[model samples]
Target: MEISWLEQVNADVPLDDEWLSSGEQLILAGMKVPKRRADWRLGRWTAKRAVTAHLELSSHPKQLSAIEIRPAATGAPEVFLDHQSADISISLSHRDGTAVCAIVPSHGVVGCDLELVEPRSDAFISDYFTTEEQTLIAQSSQEQRDHLATILWSGKESALKALRTGLRVDTRTVSASISDGLDYAIQDEDRADASVIGVSRGWYPLHVRYEERQAFEGWWQCIGKLARTAVSVPAGGPPIRLSGCPRL
Candidate 1:
């Protein structure tokens, strides 16, 4: 897997039109809001970097503009090279001016999410979280509850991304548990302090899992405190070889 991240983006920074593929250019031109354009560009920039790195590592060197990341009909990201689809699954996330992309060598759907760890109101929790999840958050210490809520929220978002349904499917339908130590391998120097126990949707149990969920907790200077989770959703396909030594 190839994972890439960008801490900040200067929306005012000029974008070289030639650097973006035609499809990407179309998408860029359609964004009317400055912030939206910046966010979208940040995500695409990170994704392109990720794809370039992956291709180089795989011994399939390619130029940046030759690759394009676009949304599939299901809203999951798809990669295209020179107008032809590529054999890889891609996922993207952005929060608080930070963006990340995850690419896998197989068909297993992948999803990732990042969010700043902060306090959430009870009303927000009641509306978005499951009863069991709320109880767990409520039981945590005041200082820990914010982090816990962020983890739950991030995990669900990742899971939903893997499910390719986003938040359109009820968040409560997907649940994730976390531990206090590294359980997965993340590429960055930032170590993950937790692991996702399980992720499910409706009556169908998605065999999605993660070895680690990294919590910023003052470690990430650029984005302050944050939490991130990444998951792999199988599309009834054979398991792809995990690039990093992700211990479950």
Candidate 2:
């Protein structure tokens, strides 16, 4: 579906597992054979409701079509429409109180992540922090801990997913740093987007663009570390914005 990422995010839809647990009779009806599946059905159901709002469709949510997930060898999700071979690019993310479903045609090989703020154990930071990251973490001011880690974690995870686009770069090999004024870095501010430069073959060959949209308030530590981040990278050259998704 051709829709703006920003507009779809603002559309209201029900996300409660309880409300969707029984399945919407009108949505699933009697298409039992293959449609009764779990995440596929529920996720699609939720997606349709949200998409419908973005499309401003007068049709009931049940009238919306079903979506199929096609994954790459490494496990990336793409939407396969029955009517066409091209899979539309869609990104899904759910934090605590809310979940977001975003889609961009083929070109939108976008990956998104959300995290809440919370307290943490000292050893927690050591688990994922590389030497450089560890230095940043230790030296970070008390007030800056959550914000600092969130940016690094988000940028790292987001970039990790971005690398899925072409090359399966090692998570340990590449790292991210954020700064408001520093070029090729991100700010530790909520909902701020950053452009990063990373090493590929020992050189900072390309700029990796990533965005951070704070999902909720408070300091979120474990959730921030556990939540998977997605990113896209070019196979052979600089990453280019995909115009649309490819046919599966």
Candidate 3:
């Protein structure tokens, strides 16, 4: 698997239209919001770069713009080379000028989510988390509460993405169990009671990973951090490991 990251997208930076395929050009041209356009462009840029790095493609094999990503019927991103589907599974998430792409072999699926480390409201937690997860969070020390809560929430999102439903599923349907050092076990909706959760079903034994990126606090200061989490299918097999953080 390969992970790519890009921080602080600049709206003014000129994007080379030649780097985008014909289908991508239409998607880009149809956008009306400036910020939305920048995010869409940045995500494609990061995903293409990731695909190139994974395939180890030299400039001769293909041009960067030749790769294209389009949505499948389920709305999961699909990679195409010269407008043909490539045998690869991918997941994407971005927020607050930050973007990330996680790619893996087509046999299995993967999902990733980025979130800022901050306090969450009681109502938000109560509505999204199960009773067991809430008890675990309450057991943590005061200082660890924020980090733990954010990570748990991010983990749920990642699991949903791996299932290709994204946030459309109820957050409470998925449960998270954090052990040590950001390692967690996810019992997807399948583990839930069918009658209570409305017959929700998904992959089981999903693995969860947590990582953070340092945030710059001042001109010469970098003190804060952003939390990120990911989940993948075929859980009992080889664990999905994260690579080094990408440079901003």
Candidate 4:
């Protein structure tokens, strides 16, 4: 199945539970507080605003309520909705003024992440990346680190979303190696680790795409990993070409 990607920045937005309760909300690190809402409220509301719009449900406010995130028996985020049954999986993330929500139809898991392009301090880098991942950064050029950080953050967050664990899992254990565009290679963990990461884990192809929100000036991206079992062929090979990869 083809993955869907959507991006938007709302000039007039007010973050509130009324807006957030409807759509699954994600809050990042930085965001300005709306007039009446508290600081924490705005962060989440802004995230909701972006997510609802991405879902193409902004036109109908009530539809946001249709998207719900209730804890599963395993304590992971599981989407439950009677809105429209196209079989959608959603992941929400936000930081500062930027937020992102990714939805994949009829897919077991999906993830989306957005990050402000900021330089990482040596200490911060050391804290976040594992020894192996640090080696990759040390070998990278200045330009590569600046750009790759986004991929690193996005890939990890996206993976967490698909895994439905959010940040409950150790960040360092999940590593995403993006040589180009965005694809994932789990560095810190093995196949068993992937299973604990979410309802459907292990190695699955991730589709990632991003756009810079001018208003938020943040990079928002979408990622998806297709889950399938009983493979006709060995794993780690090219996907079976049904017709063709669809244009998102």
Clashes within 3 Å, all models in order: 3, 17, 1, 6
Q: How well is each residue in 1-248 modelled by candidate 2, as lDDT tens digits? A: 23222211222333433223233434455556652334345445445544444444432422354333445686565554433444345555454433444444566455544455444456766765566776876787776676556655655655554445332554444455543322212232332221122111111122233224222111111221222233432222212222211111
Q: Of 1 and 3, which scores higher on lDDT?
A: 3
| Candidate 4 error regions (>4 Å) | 10-58, 65-78, 82-86, 181-248
Error of 4 at 65 (Å): 4.3
* Residue range with the least summed lDDT across 10 consecutive positions in model 4: 226-235
> Once superposed on the true structure, which residue ranges of model 2 sit more than 4 Å away at CA?
1-46, 49-59, 70-73, 83-87, 165-170, 181-248
Point out the higher-scoring one by lDDT: 3 or 4. Answer: 3
> lDDT of candidate 4 vs native?
0.43
Instruction: Evaluate residue 168 in candidate 4 and report its C-alpha lDDT on the 0 to 100 scale.
Output: 79
Candidate 2 structure, TM-score to reference: 0.52
lDDT of 4 by residue, 11-102 (tens): 33444444444334443223345532343343333333434544545434454455555545644444554543335555555444333344
Candidate that scores best on TM-score: 3
lDDT value for candidate 1? 0.58
Instruction: Output the better candidate (1/4) by TM-score.
Output: 1
What global local distance difference test value does model 2 have? Answer: 0.41
Instruction: Give the per-residue lDDT digits (tens) of candidate 1, residues 37-95.
Output: 88888777667666665565331223667888888787788888778898777778887
Root-mean-square deviation per candidate:
9.5, 11.3, 12.4, 13.2
